[model samples]
Target chain A: MSHTTKEKSKLLARIRRLKGQMEAVERALEAEMPCGDILNLVASVRGAVNGLMGELIEDHIRMHVVDPGTETDSERAKGAADLIDVVRMYLK
Target chain B: MSHTTKEKSKLLARIRRLKGQMEAVERALEAEMPCGDILNLVASVRGAVNGLMGELIEDHIRMHVVDPGTETDSERAKGAADLIDVVRMYLK
Candidate 1:
């Protein structure tokens, strides 16, 4: 099995949590929660989704673009690191 | 400015490509493309999305869970590496 298949369960768990957070936002809306409260819930869901996205993007760069373990070009390595840093900041 | 903000243009370019891919799928559907062709287009879109997600998720782990730079614990580093491998595999 590929690394992803082996780790599918953990990834699914994170997705499930995101789903639950989204549901919470839905529930808050259904109950007619205060605008500020609903906004907070929505923001929470957004953050969770962003976090999930960030994790996946980082791996892609490491595996496909530049594996720090094997990459030798200092300039390329710095670029990859910079991209990763930006991705993290964007998600936040 | 945050790294993300600084890199926003490049990130946005990727997002636009994804959007264009999605639109291509939609156009194919509207043009009454064969099921196989449509399926291929859809698969392309899915792959693009997975790639995007993978990049984001990898960055998240590095930034929040275990940045390779400062992390010193061998066990923790191994775990992070393992997780990143799985994420890359899964997204593939």
Candidate 2:
């Protein structure tokens, strides 16, 4: 996957933020934070992760499913299969 | 996205098998399998899940990156950005 420099940089920043979120959860667990609070933080992070996944999946499908350019039959079929599998796994 | 009926059927079957594997891990834990055995089963499930993720990612990237049709400029850029974000998140 290719991206403009700024887009790549922004995404890298998001990943760093996500890493920090993960660390916060670890710290909360180790510090014996209240279970409810810790779980709340975890749920927030999971939502963020899922948001990222939905964006990724939407972009991928739009590119492949909506506008697969002059690709071979097998490749087009593969894109379809990928969409089905992704929806099956993540939507579940 | 479309596939032949047989192809779709096969993929669905694989997903069902994966679901069965997940259930086996749950049953192993509840049945008081040895700690080592339980951990091993968990690890196996994790590996299988990662394998599925890799396959899905590969197919998505190939379709979007290699053969995106005459998509709008923003759509193309978004696809690139999505790929970068996915790599950043999962490859870390």
Tens digit per residue, CA lDDT, model 2, A1-92: 43334257766777788889999999999999999999899998888777666655554554434344444556555565565456546532
DockQ, per-model, please? Answer: 0.03, 0.14
Which candidate has the highest lDDT of all? 1
Off by over 4 Å in 1: A1-92, B1-7
Error of 1 at B26 (Å): 2.1
Stretches of candidate 2 exceeding 4 Å from the true structure: A1-33, A63-88, B1-33, B60-92
lDDT of 1 by residue, A1-92 (tens): 34345568988999999889888988988999899999898888887877887777666656544555566766446656765776676554
lDDT of 1 by residue, B15-76 (tens): 99998988998898889989999888888888888788777666665664466556676644
Highest-TM-score candidate: 1
Model 2, residue A25: C-alpha shift (Å): 10
The CA lDDT of each predicted structure is: 0.72, 0.62
lDDT of 2 by residue, B1-92 (tens): 43333246756776787898889888987897899988887787777767666554544554434333443556554554555455446532
Give candidate 1's error at residue B81 in angstroms.
1.4
